[model samples]
Target: MRLPILLLTLALPLLSQGQTADDIVKRYLDKIDGSKKWKDVKSMITKGEYDYGGIVFPFTTYAKAPSQYKFVVPFNGKYYAQGYDGNSGWKIDAFKNETTPTLLNGSQARAMANEADVELEIPFINYKAKGHQIKLEGRDTLDGKQFYIITLLKSGGEKETYYFHSTTYSLYLKKSIAKNIELEKALLDT
Candidate 1:
């Protein structure tokens, strides 16, 4: 009897943690954009700079719903581009001397297609339906600032961890590892 009661007390916190994780994600999403508006998102275009080994290159990304995407980077007066046009994937790399648009195949094509698919929707919105899982990993400090740590396991086995502001509930940092690629993004303006 006492053993069972002790077990229940221990399990309660564990169970509540999952619920709390879900609630935190919901609040973050609502703060970014309501669920209804998230679903209505059809396309997005983002222009930014990619820094590689101290070299900064301007890049543009275009994505559309139903799986369409294009990424372009201009260098040395030449354009390097990758795109998935709903059905097929293609690329043009000036450094590789592939001036003509080359149709991507095999893993390359699949990777580009996957990017388009994910670009259509923001993760954490209907994460369960998307076959992903999220968990609250307690609190942590980043850059001398306190934050709530949340980790997301994507359906494809990728892992992503997010840091939300302890008080604002806004996402402050995100780190992800997918297919041998690791990326860390800071959302200071977000």
Candidate 2:
């Protein structure tokens, strides 16, 4: 989904040298979310496309504070839905002949649960309190542009690497790899 306001705030500058991970994170957050507007958001609805392989599906996402989220996508004349109610994670895969909500378990469940909790605020905000660790992994270049690499180690041991534009200080890309699980869990659970 498009974050219109945050996208418009990407003009901030980055640290020059000897910047710690925390310092970089603070500046990044301040630039894009200085007003802390997300704190006042109790709920949100985002409509977008879900790209699967080379195909795409139109989807609508519903999120409410304190851990509630749902997304529905229509495919082949049927609607498929997945969500986490305040208590449990569930999904209905119409293609699999599952028309009713089925409780999720294992990594899938934990991933969804974690997503509901984190989506209320921007990622990296209070990351230590969230049991995540960050490190400045030096710099890297992608397509001729310089970027600062910051890696986040999740409590679950999942690793996510964020690429921030060196000059603009905007997030350019994020890459993640599951430490143990077969499927890599996404930071946004996207």
- Which candidate should be chosen as best, given TM-score against the real structure? 1
Question: What TM-score does structure 1 among the candidates reach?
Answer: 0.67
lDDT for model 2 comes to 0.71
Worst 10 residues of 2 by lDDT: 178-187
- Over 1-190, each residue of candidate 1 has an lDDT whose tens digit, in order, gives 9999999999986774554788888888878885778777888886666555456667677888888888787889887888889899888888788878898888787777776674556788889998999989998887998788888898978777888886677988666422201112211111
lDDT (Cα atoms) of all candidates against the true structure: 0.74, 0.71
Weakest ten-residue segment in model 1 by summed lDDT: 180-189
Output the number of the lDDT-best candidate: 1
TM-score of each: 0.67, 0.61
Runs off by more than 4 Å, candidate 1: 1-19, 46-60, 73-79, 140-144, 178-190
- Per-residue lDDT tens digits for candidate 2, residues 1-190, read 4677566555333326677788778778877884377678788886655445446566667888878888787878887787888888888888778877888889878866765563666568778887999999998899999988999987778777888887777877766432212124212322
Candidate 2 error regions (>4 Å): 1-17, 44-61, 71-80, 103-115, 129-131, 177-190
